[model samples]
Target: MSLDQPAPPAGQDDSTGREFTSALEDDDVLRAEHVSKRFGAVTALVDVNLHLRKGEILGLIGDNGAGKSTLLKILCGFQRPDAGRLIVNGEEVQLRSVDHARALGVDAVYQDLALINQLSVYHNMFLKREKVHWPLLANRGMRRAARNYLDEMGVNIPSVDAQVASLSGGQRQAIAIARTVYSEAKILLLDEPLAAMGVKEAAIIMELVRDLKRRREVSMIIIAHNYGQVLEVCDRVNLLQHGEITLDKQSKDTSVQELNDIVVEEYRRALEQRQRAAS
Candidate 1:
C-alpha cells in the first residue's frame, strides 16, 4: 500500500470508518501473524509473529539457521508461508510474487546487492523500470533522475555514469539502496547492508540509515549479526531462536550483555536436551 494512504483499523475502515492513524501512535505498517513455514521434514518457522512500525528500523538478528532469511524471504514475497496471513496497511494480502510485493511498496536489498557490475550507476538505478520516451529508453531523463535521487539520499559518488564495478563497496551499497527507495518502496528489507565494510564505510551506511529514519518516509527491517550495530541503528530488535521470535525489546531497554545471556541460556538448554536424549 502507498504510505500516503490513510490507514484504518484492520476491520474498522469497512464498518466504523475509523482512520488507521488512530489505531496506534506507532502504527504497524506490516504484520505477520502466526506465520509458519516448513521445507520437507524441516520446520523453518513456527508461528512467528512480527510487526514493523512506520518510520522505524527493526533489527532481525539470530544465529545461522535461526530462520531470519526464511522470514525475510516470506516478507519479500520470494517464498510463501505454509500457514498464516500477511497484513499490509491494516488489510490482509496474499503476495503472489516479488513484483507484487514491490507494487505494494515492499523491496529488499540482499547481501549480494543484485547490481550489474558492468552497468553504469544511472543505468542500474533505472534497471527494471526504465523511463521510456516513445520507442526509446529515455537515457537523459533517467540520468537526471538518478542524479537527483542519489543527491537526495546523500550518496556521494564521482559520477552517475561511472560503472558500479569501479566504485567502492560502500558506494555500491548506497547506489543499490538509492535505486530501491527511488522506486517508491515504503517497507525496505535489508540483509546485512553493513557486512564486509571497513570502519568508515560501515559508518557511512549507518549515517545513511539514520538519515532515512529522520526522513520518516520508509520503514525498514535490517538483518545483521552485529548486536552493537543493531542497537545503534534499530529502534527495536527481534531475536529469532528455534524458528521463532524469542526476544523482542526496544534497543534502549536491552543491552549487549542481556542479549548474550539469552544466547548462552539457549545453548545450555540444547546441551541438556542432547544429554537427556543420549541417556
Candidate 2:
C-alpha cells in the first residue's frame, strides 16, 4: 500500500472495487480484530488482529499452546471468541457454527482429513451434499464431477471410485483438499496439511497447494511446523507466541533460518524468565 494512495473510508472499500490474486491488487477478504479467547483460567488469545488477503496464502507458525489452534477454531466457527469481531468481506458477521462458516465460504481441513477410509474418493468428495435426480441418486454425475475437478486441479488419483484407504498419503491429502475446493470455499484453513508425509508425498501436497494458489481460487491460512516449507509456499508468514502474533513478514522478505533464530531466541528468553520467576 502506498502512502500517497490514501486510505479506504471506514468500513468501505476503496475506489478500485476489483478483485485479483496478486498481493499488490487484492483486498482483504477476512479480518480478525482484537480477538480474544480463553479456556477456563487459561488465556488462549489476546487482542489478536489478523487479516487474510483475497488470493494470498498465509502461513501460521507457532509452538505448542501458542493460541494457533484456538484462533483456527474461532475462524472455522468451531469456537467463538470471548471478545472482538470477525469481518468477512468487510462485513462484521457472527459465526454461529461450522455450517454457518461454510455458508459464508469459509472452511477448514484439519490434519485428520475427516475422511472415511472405507468410502470411495467420489463418495467422500460429495459427502453430506450429494446430488440427486428424482427417484435415484446421481452417482454418474457425481463421479464425473469429482474426476474432472481433481483432474483440473492436477490432483493425481487412479480412480474416483477407488476407496480412499487404497490411495497413497498424498492422494488422500489431495482428496481432502479437493473436497473442500469443490464445496466452493473462498477461504480455506488447512491445519498441518503436510504432517507425517514422506518427502515425495509432501512434495506432491506442496505442488497441489501451489497449483491452487496459482489459480487464485481461494485465500488460505496454513498452519505447519516446517518453516522452510511454509516459506516456500506462503505469501506471508506470521508467528504466534504467548497467545499473540509476535511476528509477521512477507515470505520474500524473510528466510527460514531467520525465522528459526527468532523462535529460538524467544524460547531462550522465555526459559530465562521462568527461571527468574522460580528464584
Candidate 3:
C-alpha cells in the first residue's frame, strides 16, 4: 500500500563505471540497522540495514515505491523510525530532531536546491552565520569569507552578489553544495541532485563530489537513477526492494547488468514463492 506522499525530484532529464573498490578501505560514517516504518496499513520500510563510510560514496537505488524517500526522511530527522536504530561514528544516538542530525554532522541537500532567491551569493553563503559587528550584519566580512570558501573548493562562481535566481541550474547546484559544506556538514546526503542538468554540468558536480571526499572531512550518500552514476562515484551499492535490502555489493565486483539481473531474479523468485505459499 503506497501512501499519498509528494513525488520525488526529477532525475537527470539529460543523462559510474568502476574504480570504487578501494576508495573506502576502513572508514564508516553512518549505520542504520533493521529500520522500519509504517503509515496505517501501508508499510513504508522494513529491516533496512545500510552503512555509509567516510571519504567515499554509497548509492541507494530501487523502484518508485521502494521507500527511498521515506528512509531519507528518517535519516534527515523529518520522520521517526517505528523500529530499529542508527549508529553514528560508533556512538548510538537518537535523531529525535533535524537539529539532532545537524548536531551529529549530518546534512541533506534536496533536488530543489534550496537557496534564497532574493539573496546574493554572499548572503546565501553565510546565511545565518554571516559575520556581524555590534549586532549588525557585516557585509564586507561575509563576502570575503564567501570568496575564500568558493576558492577553497575550486568552484568559480561569477559573483557572490548575484542572486541565486539568476544562476544557472548547475551554478545554483554548486552554490548550494558549497553552502552545505561551509556550514560544517560532515555527512552529506544528496537526493537526485544531478537531475535536469546537462552532461558538462553533471561532470562538474561529480568532480566537486570527488573533491569533497578527497578532503576526507565529509562523507556523502548520493541518490541517482542510473547504476553507472552510482558505480562511478560510490564505493558500494545497496539496492532496496519491498522495504528490504536485496543487494549490497561493492561497485568493483559488479556490473550494471549484474545489478539489474539480481533484481529481476529476486522479483521472479518472490512471485514463485508466493504462488507456492498460496497453494
Candidate 4:
C-alpha cells in the first residue's frame, strides 16, 4: 500500500488491502521473509521480514545490541540467515557471498568504509576494480573518471590526486558512497553513514542522500541512530527491537518524540525483566 493511503481497519480482513500489499511486494526491489540468524547461543535475528521498495530510502533504527547490524549483514550477503528466503527483484535466490550480492546489484557501505588511507582518492574510488591498459595501470583514465563521477554526484573533494587520509571524514564517506553508486549498485545498504560525523559533514551526506532519492534510481536501506535525520531523508522507517521489526511506518506519519518514547519503553521493560530475574 502507498504510505500516503490510510491503513485498513483493524481486525478487518480487507481483501482489497491484501491485494494492494501483494502488488506492492511485486514492486519491492528487495525483501527478507522469515529470516532468522544465530551465533552459537546468541540469537541475532528472529523471523525478520523487511522490504525495500524501488527508488525508496528506508530508515532502520534500533537501540544498541538490537540486531540491526546482523540484519544488514544478512541482507548484503556478508552473513547468511539460518532460515528464511531473500527475494531480489521478485526472484528468490541464495546469496553465496558479498561478491555474489554485488553481482546481483546489491552493495553495502559500512561505517569503516574499507577505503585505504594511503591511496589517492581516485585510486581508492576504483580500488580492486581498477581499469588497465594492456600491462600498464590506466592512471589517467581512472583519475578522469573518478573526478567526473564525483562532480556528477555533487560530492566535493579537494582533488582526486589527494591521499584519502588527507580528506575530512565527510569527504571520505562521500567517496565511499560515490564509489558504490558508480559500481551500479541498485540496492544500497548504508550502515551508520552519519555516525560520528560533525554537523557540516553529516549535512553533506544527507544532501547526497536526498539527491539520490530525487533521482529515483536506487533503493536504499539506511541504519541510523538519529531519528530526526532519518525522518528527514527517508521515505519510510522501521523500528527493530529484540531481534524483530516491531514498527513500520511512513516517515510523515511518525515523529522523533514518538520513536524515542517507544525505545524508552523497551528499555523500561528490559529493566523490569532484569529486576524480576534478580528477585
lDDT of each residue in 35-107, candidate 4, tens digit only: 9999999998999989999999999999998899899998889999999999898888899999899999999
Q: Per-residue lDDT of 185-245 in model 1, one digit per residue for the tens?
A: 9999998999999899999999988887788479999999889999999999999997999
- Give one digit per residue, the lDDT tens place, for model 3 in 106-181: 8777767668899999898777567899788999988999989998888888998888889888888888889878
Misplaced by over 4 Å in model 2 are: 1-26, 134-136
Q: Number of clashing pairs, model 4?
A: 0
Which pairs of residues clash in candidate 3, taking residues 3 or more apart in a chain or in different chains? 12-195, 16-228, 16-229, 16-232
**Sliding window of 10 residues with minimal summed lDDT for model 1:** 17-26
Model 1, C-alpha of 100: deviation from truth (Å): 1.0
TM-score per candidate: 0.87, 0.87, 0.81, 0.91
Model 1 misplacement above 4 A: 1-26, 275-279
Supply the global lDDT for candidate 2. 0.88
Cand. 4 TM to true fold: 0.91
Q: Which residue pairs of candidate 2 clash? A: none
Clashes of each: 2, 0, 4, 0
What are the lDDT scores of the predictions, listed in order? 0.89, 0.88, 0.81, 0.91
Name the TM-score of candidate 1.
0.87
